[model samples]
Target: MKRLILGIFSIICMVTANSVQAQDKGPEFSKLDVSPMDLAIYRNDKDQPVVRVIYSRPQKRDREVFGKLVPYGKVWRTGANEATEITFYQDMKIADETVKAGTYTLYTIPEEKEWTVILNKKTNTWGAYEYSEKEDIVRIKVPVRKAPNNIEALSMAFEKANNGADLLIGWDDRYVKVPFKTAK
Candidate 1:
């Protein structure tokens, strides 16, 4: 009986030790991304954000951006990991076109002179690989302009205007502005 008790105690100790070791291993860090995630929010006077954009910022990394990494006339996910998402809390006119209050996936087609910005109904998508034109809610063509300086990471900024705002998207010495007006 003493030997059996000792054997049981030994097994318990071994199991406890193994469990402690496993606990000390911590969380696994498997996935790593060079480009990090970012967000752009435009708030109203009430401190409520009317527009929010969630996306990943990809660095230039000494590579060509527009015509190479993001080819011209091809649909781009507009970000790194997942499809860029834009949430509008209120109905607004984007580029003189009406956009209802909802969440939509923002895709882009970069060209040398102009860029076609698309708001698609499909929200949960990995990349532009699964993008469908039939699901698009709005498609606006905005002219691209030369940036004053190089923008290493992709960025979007909202500039407040009179009863409206301008959404500026810039990267790699180029930028495009999409003007929007809140629906009355």
Candidate 2:
């Protein structure tokens, strides 16, 4: 009985040691991208967040962004790793088209002068490998503008407007704004 107890104790000790070693390794580092994960929230005057977006920012890293890394007329995941996701707390009119309140995957088709911003019903996708046009909830064309300065990392922001707000996507030296208004 004593020998059996000793054997069990030894096995437990080995497992504990191995677990400690694994924990010591700490978090894994991401290669190529150093911008970190980020969240953008747009709140109403009452301090309630009406819109939220979760995304991972990828650095330019000296590589050409538009028309190359993200080819023109092709669907882009809009961010690195997992496809960027957006949530609307209430029904809203995007580019004059009504969209129901729900979570969606945001994708884009980059062009030299304009971009097609897409809000797809599908969520939790990796990249644009599984994008489906049939799942799109809204597609809006927005003009691309030159940034006053280079933006190293990909970003999204909501700026207050008359009736609602403008969703801005910026990276490198380009940006596009999509208008949205709350449904009455």
Candidate 3:
């Protein structure tokens, strides 16, 4: 009985020591991203959200955004870090183009006076480096409107409209509005 007790105690001590050593090898947290991921949800009511956008917010940091860093006529991920993704809970008419209920990667082409907002069937992509026009579901042009004030970071929000809402994307000193209507 004495030997058995000693053996059990030894096993327990070994396990405890091993556990402590294993914990010492615990996870090393990665550094936070400079452009953090963000979300924008459009809800008509408390429980009924029609649209949700997941993207990253890139700061201007006193740099020129459009026609320079972003460049004209080139596809953009619509944000920083991972490509922007938009989800439609129901069928939606975006910029007068109909899209079925699903998720899509959002891209944009920044121009001098207008921007072409694109919705691609592909998802889980990083930047516009892998953008394919063949995968695009819809591409609509929206005129750039001067920002009411200088914006330091890329921002997106939904505003109530007659039938649905309008998605506003703004950065630096310019902004654009993309219309969204419920398919009726």
Q: What are the TM-scores, per candidate, against the unseen true structure?
A: 0.85, 0.82, 0.84
| Candidate 1 lDDT trough over 10 residues, lowest sum | 26-35
Task: Assess the local accuracy of residue 169 in candidate 3 as a C-alpha lDDT between 0 and 100.
Answer: 95
Q: 1-184, model 3: which lDDT tens digit per residue?
A: 9999999999999999999999898788889788888999899766698999999999999788898889999999999988999999999998768899999999999998999999999899989888899999999999999998998989999999988889999999989998999997
Tens-digit lDDT track of model 2 for 1-184: 9999999999999999999999899888768546577988899999998888899998899999998888999999998888999999999899778888889999999999999999999999999999999999899999999988899999899999877889889999999998888987
In model 2, state the lDDT of residue 159: 97
Provide backbone clash counts, one per model: 0, 0, 0
RMSD of each: 4.6, 6.5, 6.0
Task: Give model 1's TM-score versus the native structure.
Answer: 0.85
Taken over the whole model, the C-alpha lDDT of each candidate is 0.91, 0.91, 0.92
Cα error, candidate 1, residue 139 (Å): 0.9
lDDT of 3 at 50: 95
Q: Which ten residues in a row have the lowest lDDT in candidate 2?
A: 28-37
- Cα lDDT tens digits for candidate 1, 1-184: 9999999999999999999998899888968678788899899999988998999999998999999998999999998889999999999887667899999999999999999999999988998988999999889999999999999999988999878788889999999997778987
Instruction: For candidate 3, give the lDDT.
Output: 0.92
Clashing pairs for predicted structure model 3, backbone only? none
**Would you list the rank order by TM-score, best first?**
1, 3, 2
- Against the hidden true structure, what lDDT does model 2 obtain? 0.91
